[model samples]
Target: MSERLPPNTKIRGTGFNISDFWSWGFSDVLTNSLRGVFAEFLVGSTLDVLQQPRIEWDAYDLMYKDKKIEVKSAAYIQSWHEGQYSKISFGIEAKRAYNYATRSYTPEPVRNADLYVFCLLYEKDANLIDVLNTEQWHFYIVKTNVLNTLFPQQKRISLSTLEKITQPVSFTEIKETIDQAIYQ
Candidate 1:
């Protein structure tokens, strides 16, 4: 298990601290990679799983209660500015699971998570975008069974295609919606 470090924890033989590294690396939360991790963190927070350390190579992003969750994120505004906002899509590909202990992979591809949470940063204006603001985002929750039945072979899905299936919920409703998806 990874130990949580204090912000003031110093690097040996260096003046920098953990906070310094975090500030330099994760200050831009809108970037694709960081944003995805941030979305996972947001969902984990909503599910009351923030106490758990994130496992980078885990087949699913989080395990809340008995439900395994996979989170995907997309945004209109990116860290780098272009003439137009980028198109939004989320990956839903099934892949073989990697075992850390055995140093082996599953024989076949599969959807390891029980459900998926799709997070969209809908704020179009770069200047008005605040990733920290929950109101600026929309989340769509769907059971793996339903998703697999709808688009069995689909590797990725567009926002429009996704909208036809599941309605989005606010940040505040995420946990409720997830419970509904899982329990109902």
Candidate 2:
């Protein structure tokens, strides 16, 4: 894994810095890719796993204690002009696991994580939307076994189906909920 450089690290023979690139590239937190990574960061922070830099293109998004976590995020209001709130669904497809040591993909498709954390930026009003606010987010933590049993071959899961599988938890309850899911 490549070490995460400090934001203040300066570019070679230039006035630019890593923070400059971050601001230029990732200022739009509402976009799918950035939002997904943000959700993972939130989960990692809640679980006290932000001590290390995130592993990109890994089989799972996080590892807290013994549980491997996958994070998926979607927002009601999009960065684009969708006129209305966007439809909410999360990808739950099985994927070929990547082995970092071997630097290769697994032969068979699999759900490599122990759990999934579905994060919803639930603020519908674009004018009042705040991606940084914890209250605006709702998280649903579900075991991989449950998903495999219910949606073995499904690629995406609608919000209604996700709700039926598990109720949403707030930011404060995430760690406790995950503990219960892991230990119970």
Candidate 3:
């Protein structure tokens, strides 16, 4: 009554391969977790930013010299439909306060790190969603204070709006741009 895909067989008629279909079925938690890991790997390898050791809580994801960097990633083609273009947003959360006396967290608007690096995978054609293709990925860097002031009371920002503040940089330019922002 049911049919199963043959081993080592590629599905035809559909634009996506088996892996794409498989990824499409992933839940939001798993999808976001994987995206974060991928972003960390790209930043760590390309910019030579060292990943912080695993901890229960971390304010930042990577360390570059004395500066702390937080990396965020989003792809247009997720586990759902593949549109013509992908729109990505970065979460600019208001800082949380840890009260030593109460042993609880409180809401506060504070800069969590020196810089925020946003990795966006904007596919020219959503049908070709390949993680291995670096050409499809774009990296943008912005100072936390600048973001805090520009997007006050906002929890997220779009790529287009971010470009108005600072132009997107290539992977090779990420380190240099970040250094300039840090020391400036």
Query: Which model scores highest in lDDT?
Result: 2
Instruction: State which candidate has the highest TM-score.
Output: 1
Cα deviation of 164, candidate 3, in Å: 0.5
lDDT of 3 by residue, 1-184 (tens): 1344543456788666666765665434225567677777777777665434333255677778878788889877775554544567888786774655677876665657789999887765545766666677788999988987887688888877888998878777887888889888
- For model 1, state the Cα shift of residue 157 in Å: 0.9
lDDT of 1 by residue, 89-169 (tens): 899998999988898999999888999999999999877999999999999998899778988888998999899989999
- Candidate 1 CA-lDDT value: 0.91
| Candidate 3 lDDT score at position 176 | 85
Q: Tens digit of lDDT per residue, candidate 2, span 25-118?
A: 9999988888899999999999998877887788999998878999999988888836787899999999999887897999999888999999
* TM values, all candidates: 0.96, 0.95, 0.71
Off by over 4 Å in 2: none
Q: In model 1, state the lDDT of residue 126.
A: 78
For model 2, what is the error of residue 103's alpha carbon versus the real structure, in angstroms, after optimal superposition? 3.2
The lDDT per prediction is 0.91, 0.92, 0.73
